[model samples]
Target: MLSNLIRQGIKPTPLIVCAGGTSSRCAADGLWTVDLRARHRQLIINEEREEVEVGTGLTMAEVLQGLQPRGRSIPVGLSTIPGCGFVLTGGIGPLTRSQGLALDHIVGLCGVWGNGNIFDLSAPTNPASPGTASKNETHQQWKGLLGAAPFLAVVTAIRLRTQKLTPLVIWRSVCSVQQLEIAIEAAETWEHSASLQWAWNDNIELFITCCADDPAAMEAMQSLRTHLGYCPESSMAIVAGQHAQPAFGTMARAADPQERIHSEVISRLGPAWGQRLPSLMADLKELMNNRPHAGCQISAQQLGGASAQIPVSRTSFIHRNAIWKPWINATWMACDAKGQESALAWLMRANNLLSDYCPGVHLAQIHPHLSCHHQELNDAFKNWLPGLKHLKSHLDPYGLLPPL
Candidate 1:
């Protein structure tokens, strides 16, 4: 179908490869949209290998449901609304500190390149497994696709490595700015089994979830509590054998869902950013107070542990050493053009204040309008850009896919 479109000299305004229209990346005025909603919905479980082959059309919720019965789970981002694009771009989730990014767990992928050529990239089923491509070539391609597939192709399916399902204990508490700072500092040295996310919406709240079965995880949770000087007003919940989906869901429910929202996101990566949390929080508070829209906010996610252990050279994801991903966003009703402009201006001001502390940005949260597209490509892939560009030329000579 892609070939037919290209052959007929038809260019889709933006080829959005998602089943649901939940992604903010979708082009509002695209001339054509190739929906992958019903294209690949298969789920094949390889119980022996503890891996699952899933169609790109499947939502994270569906994938989780499939894995639930098998006593396995995959690390995923905060929202269950994503599909292949999540893994294609760097899947940072609540369990990322322990299991690593979803991209890190991928064992194989099948996709249609921009030029409409079918390509299958997979790890050897076994050490003795035979393959046409040389080991070096396969390794290079694997690294490339781990983070750059979105700019190169439309993924049809993916085979991801899964871990045994485990119980999680989640703690939620409202904190003062000073207490939040202390919590952020403690999170920097948290164990792999523990992760933290705190948000400022009217009042500041910290959400900490840990793998209950791990003694070290429990200890780390205690350490965080001690650092924050826990208050009696805090609330906590313990799930026997479940992911942090419920916690994420609760946060989502708190937000008012608008049918149309115009927003700009700026994500910065660096360990120094964590050190400057207090000042960052101050800036966020000011922004929120003067927000042009009601839902405009700033948030951050902790990144480190096993994710930091993965070297940049090992994959196209260049921000492996980045310990925190702090993002600022401004959202207003899409129909309110004037409000959107004001919100965007406010977002830029907030971004400028924090830009100096951030040395890099995450690809998933990139916006072409706020930052230079080419510069973003350089920052994201760094030295890997040349090789990626070369591959892009070979696979997408017409540049049908989104520009990196």
Candidate 2:
């Protein structure tokens, strides 16, 4: 791949940095990439609540399913699929309101630096050697590696705090923006807010989805319902009305009533609305009734749960503070240039809206509009820039890792 790029007179891009290719089909056009699993070999969950150590390869779903049996789980995105790319970009999910993005819970990480040196970093205390050294010494050691980005390394593993696995309750429905705005406004104003939330406008291809769990989920839902003020006719008469059918992949799953309606709606992905954005609630209803798109589906997740406690000073993830993260997806019958271009254009618009309030996004999913240079991007991390740069200098002087 490197030789091909050089032969083509193109500069060498980073290796193993592309994500799962869900963000855009064009991502598959790139060469040399790795998923979370290929990068790390093992996953270790401590006997007690000590901590969970994960290889970069594990997806959010894998992490949850692995640890849930042990009464422990880490906050991951709703799209529990695996990839180090999201965490590197910014991990947001149902845990954002509570646990925050996956990156926030990360206490330590192991990865190969640009110079090919492997390094392990964590908060001052070393769990593997708890009794070997004084707390002071361990803390001093951990403090030496904060604010570092993958610019110096390809992350292989991560250690993070964990919590008990609780039953999840999902409430969803398809409605127009008008019906949804009431809920959206309530959710936006809630004391703690949602764990995950997202919306799709007219120009975008997908309808929005949001999720909120934990104790506050019930309360948030109630608040949203109250603000939405659903009436009997209005509720039952939403877009697609009662005749909506579920999309292909979603038909087999057991979902809440709202999800059933949402599944029916978001499947529609044509250029129907023109320039006028659909009312949040109305759009959802239309999606259920219309099944608009021939090749795409749109959705969003409400983030809450364990995601709120963590701050933004950790790794490269920066959406730890948003109310929700939105995703625009396109699935076509074939992978071709035309299909790829259509998906990319729609995704670009959706991502542009998503990045409005949430700036930092997964680099793998980055759209050209969101592109930024080194210095401007560095300033986004504030005081942490100096430390990350220092780590890059020490671990990857050649800057082989992908540029953030």
- Residue-wise lDDT of candidate 2 within 1-404, one digit each (tens)? 32233234322455544333344311334545545445464679986655888776666566666776677776555455645555554465554555555556667777655665555766643334446455643343333233234455566677888865544434444444465454555555555534324334332211222232334646666556566565432221111110121121242123312311111111111111222334434544454333333434455555544444444533444334544443445433343556555555554444444344345433324332233345334434546556556656655565555454
TM-score, prediction 2: 0.63
Best by lDDT: 1
What's model 1's TM-score? 0.89
Instruction: Please provide, for model 1 over 1-404, each residue's C-alpha lDDT reduced to its tens digit, 9 standing for 90 to 100.
Output: 65566545545534655544455665446556566667788989999999999988888878888898888988877777777677778888777887788888888899777787777888644433445566755666667788888777777889999989887778878777778777777777665678878766556667778777778888888877776674875767777454444554234225565567767776767774555667776876777789787677777777778888776766778888877777776788978889888988887787667666666767875454454566667767888899888878877777777776
Report lDDT (Cα) of residue 293, candidate 2.
35
Where does model 2 exceed 4 Å of error? Answer: 1-13, 17-30, 34-39, 125-150, 192-217, 226-299, 302-315, 318-321, 329-339, 342-394
